[model samples]
Target: MATILSLSNVNKNFGALTVSDDVTFDMPEGQALGIIGPNGAGKSTLFNLIGGTLAVSSGTVQFAKQDVTRVPAAERCRMGIARSFQIPHPFVGMSVYENLLVASSFGNSGHHDAKAECRDILDRTGLLPKANRPAGSLTLLERKRLELARALASGPKLLLLDEIAGGLTEAECHELVETIKGIRDSGVSIIWIEHIVHALTAVVERLIVIDFGKIVAEGEPSKVMADPLVQEIYMGISVDDTAA
Candidate 1:
């Protein structure tokens, strides 16, 4: 498979604290890459660097073979990179369809038809029936789906998802995982940072575990999670004592 994104010797620092230390990886096209880590592990910061939300302190970001370390966020969106925040923050007053339309128009250079794209986005995201409802009235699950739809509206080849299943109920997370699977089936490469392990395992063929700013494990989902180091990180997080 072709490489969709590459991080080479990436480094990000906050004053004297190093958030990302010599991080390197490649997200292959049409594949799902799962990133799991404890809170404050610089997982989201890694996404910010790839999606152009934050400037890297040092190193390179290559997307689709073009170096995008200095590229502005909006330009990166137009270049086929789109990310959803951990917390869904849609335009509260706008309808779901309207929000998607705005993303398609602005993020994709105003080339898409507003009405057509809005309907298609809603349909694709399982939000067609809620298209006319105000975004603020959505439940947590709906909000998560909208966040995904907004990213999809940008027509991304590489999607960066940040803890999308954080607050969803178990059943809702399963539904959302299916939605994500549909997205992957449509040929988009996904790099999802999620704490919902089951959902991640269901969708991602490969998993990468990061700790203290660097990846400690990367391989098939079951294999990576079974590594002693990976098991150690998740040891106290859940009451379920079964091994990964």
Candidate 2:
């Protein structure tokens, strides 16, 4: 299992507030890594650091065996790193197909046939039927799917997903889990930051729990979720104190 992305003693801060504290982790090729934590646990901030949306205060970030701590976001995307926002931000005036076309053309370095690539991603994301619809008209789930399609259109080896399962109906979430499973099966590595425990449990081989900007636990999903510290940090005392 070769490493696709590695963070070594990474740290980030905004004024006196520390968001990521010496956090370190690795994603192996073709594996899914789930991140869980309570609110304000810096899960999203960690993604920002990895995707180059924010500068690390200290430490190193390596992608594909190359140091990328100083790489720009666009360069990171071109280097096979792509991410979806926690909030969907589709191009407001653009059609869904057009949105993906832009992602294919620009985000992917204009290296692929934008139309074909866009249609393929839209189909995989279950957005094909709505391809010509205006992005601004989509419902929440559709918006989220479009967000994922945009990222996928970038053709990444490492995909950073931020709560793509959030705000979906149970059936929709299940559908999304299957979609993600297929994506993983295709050999793209993923680091998913999500609060939907069951969704993650179904798709990820491993889990990492973070608290107050630091990793608290990392292991197989069940074991990581059952860890006492993880229960305390994510599920609070109720989970830790519950009877067997």
Best by TM-score: 2
Candidate 1, number of clashes:
0
Give per-residue CA lDDT, model 1, range 1-244, as digits (tens).
8898999999999999999989998878999999998777899999989999999999999999999999999999999999998878999999998888777887754544668877887987789999999999998878988999999998888999998888777887887898899999999999999988989999999998888898888999999888988898876445443433
Clashing residue pairs in candidate 1 are: none
Model 1: CA > 4 A from native? 109-112, 239-244
Query: What is the model-wide C-alpha lDDT for candidate 2?
Result: 0.89
CA-lDDT, candidates in order? 0.88, 0.89
Return the TM-score for each candidate structure: 0.93, 0.94
Range of the 10 consecutive residues with the lowest summed lDDT in candidate 2: 235-244
Candidate 2 per-residue lDDT, tens place, 69-188, comes to 999998899888989999999997999998877767766455546787778888889999999999999998889998899999888899999999988889989999999999999999
Q: What residue runs in model 2 are displaced by over 4 Å at the alpha carbon?
A: 109-112, 237-244
Cand. 2 TM to true fold: 0.94
